[model samples]
Target: MIDEHATPDLLELAARYGVSREFVDWRGRLTTVSASTLIAVLRALDVDASTPDAIRSALGDTELAPWRRPLPASIVQRAGDTPWIFVHLPHGAQFRAWAVLEDGSTRDIPQIDNWIDPREVDGVLTGRATIVVPADMPRGWHELFVAITDDGATERIARCPLITVPERLNTAAANDETKRFGIMAQSYQLRSNTSWGIGDTRDLGALASWGARQGASFVLVNPLHAPAPVEPIEPSPYLPTSRRFRDPLVLHLDVIPAVQLLEGPDAERFATLSRRATALNATPTIDRDVVWRAKREGLELLFDYDLKDPVRKRAFGMFCEREGQELVDFATYCALAEEFGADWRAWPQALHDVSGQAVSEFRDTRADRVEFWRWVQWLTEEQLLEVQRSACEAGMSLGIMHDLAVGVHPYGADSWAMPEALARGVSVGAPPDMFNQLGQNWSQPPWRPDRLAELGYKPYRDMLRAALRCGGALRIDHILGLFRLWWIPEGQTPDAGCYVRYDVEAMLGILALEAERAGALVVGEDMGVVPPETRDTLAHFNIDGTSVLWFERGMSDEPLAPEHYRAHALASVTTHDLPPTAGYLKLDHVRLRHELGLLEVALEDEIQRERATIEEVLDTLRARGALASAASSVEEHTLALHRYLASSSARLMGVSLADLAGDTRSVNQPGTHREYPNWCVPLGNGSGERVTLEQVIASEWAVTLLEASRR
Candidate 1:
C-alpha cells in the first residue's frame, strides 16, 4: 500500500519514475517507504512532488518533456533485435535521419510508424515519428543525425546518441567455453623487490608475468582508483577520491621515462628517496601517507623537469586530447584540493564552482599546478597501460583484471564535479540484516537515477570506459547496485532507509556495449543476501557472478556440490572481505569480529555456530576426496578448499595469493574503518612471515597451489 500522504496521482507518478513505494525487506516482510523519504528522494531527482497539485503538474511535465526534445538523448537496440525510436516534430514536419558509425560510415534509417495526430506540448503542436533501426545494425555508440523540414523549409538539424547493445556479453573465454582460472590479490599489498614501500604498477606487471608462467589465465586485483593526493592519505583502495584516475603513488619511480633525465644531484637525491622507501617496505603495515610523501617529493622533481623526447611529449599531448574536459576537470579539482582541502564542500565559495569565473581565474594563476596534476595522470596512465600490456604479452587470457569500487567518497572529486547528478540528502547503504543488525551507511552519495537517464547515462558509460580501457577484465565491486540501492537519508540511521530502483535494462545494456567494444570480461560480485532473480538477470546479460567456497551451501548442512555450481560464475575459495583461506580455517574472522564487538550473539554461541560451519566444509571436502593430507594444517586446509573450488563447473576459478602464501590474515574486514587495519595489511604466508612478490613468485608453495588450480 502507498503511504497515506501520497495520493493516487502521486503514487502513479512515482511508479512511472521507477521510485519504489514498498518492497520486501531483508526479513521477508512487507516494508513501506516513508512519505518523507519518498518526497525527499523525489526532490533529489528534481521531481516537483511537494504537494498533490505539484505532483499533477510534474506528471504533465513528464508526459510533454519528450516532445520538447527533437529526439531522446540516447537510443538502445539489441544486437539482432530491432527497436524503434520515437521522434517528436512540429506538426507537418518532415525529417530525414541516418546513423553515423564509429568508422565515420553512415546508414540511412527510415520512419516506419504511421502519422499520429498532433498534440499540444508546452504550446507547441508536436507530432510523432517512429524511426526503426535495422535488425543487423552493428553494436556500438553511434551518432544519429536528422535534417528536419517544417513550414515548407528545411533548416533545422538535430542529433542524438544511438547505442546498440549486445543482448548478452560473450568474453573471449566464453568463445571456447573452457574453464579458466586466475589469481586474486590486493594490488596494494603485493610488494615486490622494486616497489617503493607499497606495491606499484611495476609489482603488478611482475605478478602478472609470473602468474601467466604458472598457468594462470588472469591476475585479478583490488581497485587502483586514485585516492586524494595529500597527507593523511587514504589506505583503502575501495575509498577513492576519483574512480577515473590512478594515484601517482603507484608509479615505480625508477621506471618513469622522465626519471632518466634527472641530472647529477637530482639523480642522487632520487635514489636516496628510493632507498628511504626501502626501509619502510620491511614493515608489516603499509603506511600509504609515508609512501605517498616519499614518492611525491621525488615526482615533484620530475614534474619540474622539461621534456626532451618529442615522441613521448606528443603521446602525452594526444592522451590529454583524448581525455578532453574530464581530465581537465579532474586535474583542476586536484590542483584546487592541494590548495584547499580534500573535501571540496569545505573550500572557499569563490573556488567552489569548477567552471565558474572565479575558478577560471584560479586556473589561470595556477596553470602550472594544474598542468602538473594532469601530467601526473598521464604518467599513471602510461604505467597502467604497460602493466596490462605486459600481462597480455605474457600470454594471459584476461590480464590485470581491475576492480571497480561501488561508489566514490562523499566529499571527493566526483561528488563535487557532478553535484546535480548525485543525490545529496541520502547516502548509499544497506538495510539491517542478520549479520549486521545496526545496518550500514557507506557515506558515498548515490547517483540520481532520474538525472542519470536524463543525461543519457553518460556518467556511467564514461566510468566503464575508463575502467576497461587498460584491462582485459573488470570486476564490478557491488554489481547488485545496477538493480537497486538502499538509500539512507542524511542525519538518519540506515534502519530508516528504503530501496530505490534503477533502470537496470538501460544500465546493463550499456555495460554490455562497452564490454563488447573493449573485448573485456565482466565479473559481478553478486554475493551476500542477493535477491532471487539477480543471478538469472545477470546471466541474461552474460555478466559472470562470483561464487565463494565458504558460502556455497544449500539448505542442508552439506556444502553445495561442485557440479551444482552455476556454470557462468567465477568460483573462488575466499574473497577480500573474509580472512585469507588459511586464517579462515583458523577461525581468525570470529576472533576479529569478537574483537571489534561486531558479534551480536554470545561469543560462545558464535564460536559454536562457526565450528559447525567449518566442520561441514571439512566433512564435505573429505567426502568429495578433495583433501590430500591427513594433517589439518592451515596450508593443507586452504589447498583442499581450493581443490573443491577447482572441481566446480564454474567457468572461472580464482585462487588467492594470500592462500598460496598460507596467510591467515584478512586484507579487509567489513564493518570496521580504522578498527582492524582493514586495507593496509602486508601479504604474509601461513608461517606468519611477510613475503614480497619476488619471494612468492619463486616459492614452491605457489607452484603446488597452481597445480591444484589447474587440476
Candidate 2:
C-alpha cells in the first residue's frame, strides 16, 4: 500500500520546514514530527491569507488538534459527600466522560446531546459545557477524565485531566513574621582552613553559622545537578545530564565512614588526592573536571567497602525506591553514554532506545555499575540534606532557594528518558529583541506542550516536586515559557521561529497547587518582552516578579526612583547575566562585550549613552541629598546605588557576591561560548588578586554591604 519512491526526501522536507534532516529521520518517517516542524508544514500546506490573527488561530487549532479542550473552572464537594463536578467545553463535541476514583477504577458517565456551541465572543471563538455529579457519588478523592469521541469510533480525539475534588489543604503558613533573603553560592567557593582545592559541606556549615550571626535567612546554591559520568565534563550547571540528582563532585569524602576503612595503595592514592583537593581551594577559578575526577577516583576505591555497609545499603535501597524507575534509567543512560559517547543516537543499535530489550540486557549484565551510579546519587542527596539542616540550625528562616533552568540539554538523560515529551527537531530560543538582535538558540529541546497535556502534566509535576523538595523557594528561569515559547527549528535562524502557545490556565493551576503544597513562595524571572497580561496573571496567583535596576525607567525619559519599585517583586541592582555594580560603574562590561564580539557599532554607541545617563542619575541622587557626600568615587557610587536598591519598596533583594568584591568579569556571556570564558571568574579580592572563599566573606566590602543592608 506504500509507495517508497513517492515519499518526500527527508532532507527536502527538512529544508521545507527549516529543520535538521537528522531530527526528521530520527522520528522515523513523516508521520511524526517536532512541534516546530509540524506547525511549519501545516502553514505551507494551508496557503491561507497570512494575518497575525489567522496564523495564530490556525496554529492553535490545527497543530494542536490532537490536544485542545476546556475543563470546569473548579470542582466542589462537602465533607463525607459524593463529589459534584462541572466542565465547560470549548465546542459542542461529543465527549466520552469518566470519573477516575481514588481506587484507580474509571466509571463512565453517559454523554448528553448538544452541550454547547462556539460563538464569536470579543472576536474569539468561545464555548462552554457544564456537568454536575450526584451528591452521593463517592466519599474519598477523585479526578475526572474527559475525552472527545471520534465519529463511528470508540477512540477519543482530545482528552483533558482535571482535579475532581480536594480533601484538605495540608500545608501550613510560616509562623514567623520575619522577611527572608537568600544568596546563591558555588560549593567550591566555601573553603575552610583544612579544605582541599574548593569549599566542601564543612565550609558550607561554617558559612551558615556566619550567616546566622548576620541575620540572613538562607543560602541558595547553583544547580547541584549531576554532571556527566565521563571525564573532560561540561562545567556549566545549566547543561547538566540529570537535573533530578545532585553532583557527587561536591560530596565531602572525609565525612564518609567507609573511606577510613580503606588500606594499601588505594588508601595512599586517596591521601594524595585529598592533599591536592586542599590545594585547589586556594586557587582562583573552579576546575570542575579536575575536582570531579579526583572525587571519582577516590570514590571507586571505597565502592567495595560501601557494598558491605548495611546502613548505607539500606539508604541506597530507600533512595532507589523513592526515585522509582526514572532514576535507574537515568543512571543506566549515564553509564552507557560515557562508554559510547554523549549522544544516544551514536550508541549501538540495541542500546539506542532505552525501552528496548538491548538496554534491559545491558542493565542485567552491568548491575554492579548501575548500583554504583545509584549509590552516588544517594550520597549526594544525603550531603545536600545535611547542608539544608545546617542552614536551619543556623537560624535561617529559609534554608535554600534553588533555581530551575528553562530547559534541559538536548543530548542529556532527561531527553533520552522521555523522548515523547520533548520536541526532537526543534531547539528552544529567544526571538530577536533589542538586546539580542541576532536572537539566541539555546540548543536545548523544549517540551511538546500537546504531549504534556495529553499525559496530564505528570512529568512536569514530578519535575517541580523534585526541585521544590529541598528548597524553601524556587526561582523559575524564563518563567514566560510557561505561557508560550519561541521554537526555532534545528537548522533555522531564530528569526524564522514561531511562537508556540501553552495552556496558561493549566500551567498556573499546576504552579499554584505545587506552591501551596510545598508551602513555598514562587519568584518568576519575568524579563524581556513579556506579554501585557503576564504580570496580572502572576499577581493573581501571588507569584513575585523580578525587577532589575538597568531596565527600570519611567514614561517621560526619567529614571525609575527607588520608591517606584514594585512591592511584590525582587528588586536587584543586577542579575547574573548583567554586569556587576562595580563593572557597570567602571564600564568594564562594555569592554568585555567588545572583546567577545557581542557588541556592534550601533549597540556600542547606545551603551556609551546609557552609561553617561547612569552617571548623571547618580549625580542627581547626590544633589538631592539621597546619596552621601562620600559617594564621589566610582566605587562609592556603586555602593550608594546598592544602598538605594536595598532601601526600595520591593519585598525581596538579591546582592551578587561578584558586586560585593567589585568582580568585573560576568558569570555568563550571552552570545559567545568558546570566544568568552564564561562561568569561570572568581570573586576578586580588591587587591588585584583573585580571592579565596574565606577572603570573600571576610572582605571589608562584604562586611560593609552586609551592615548597610541590615539597616
Q: Indicate which candidate wins on TM-score.
A: 1
What tens digits encode model 1's per-residue C-alpha lDDT throughout 1-711? 334576778778777777778877667888787776777667767787778778888998888888898888677777888777888888888899999987789999988966678899878888989888898888787888888899888569988878788888876744446788999988888888778889898888998898898888899988888888877888878888888787787888887778878999998999899998978889879999889889988888887663457887788789889988888888888888888989988899877777789888887899988888888889888889999999989999888898999888888888877776788878887776765667777878888887786676788888899899889899998898899888887788887877778878888999988888788889999976578898999989988899988778776736898999988888898899888877877788888888888787887888889888887888888877887537477777767777778878999999988877778888887777778888888988776678988888888988898888883
Model 2 residue 24 CA deviation in Å = 31
Give the per-residue lDDT of model 2 (tens digit) for 311-365.
Answer: 8788878889999998899879877876887777788878868899999988898
Q: In order, what lDDT does every prediction score?
A: 0.83, 0.66
Off by over 4 Å in 2: 1-98, 101-160, 164-179, 186-200, 282-284, 602-604
Off by over 4 Å in 1: 1-10, 115-117, 304-306, 555-557, 628-631, 686-689
Q: Candidate 2: deviation at residue 8, Å?
A: 25
Q: RMSD to native for every prediction?
A: 2.5, 8.4
- Supply the TM-score for candidate 1: 0.94
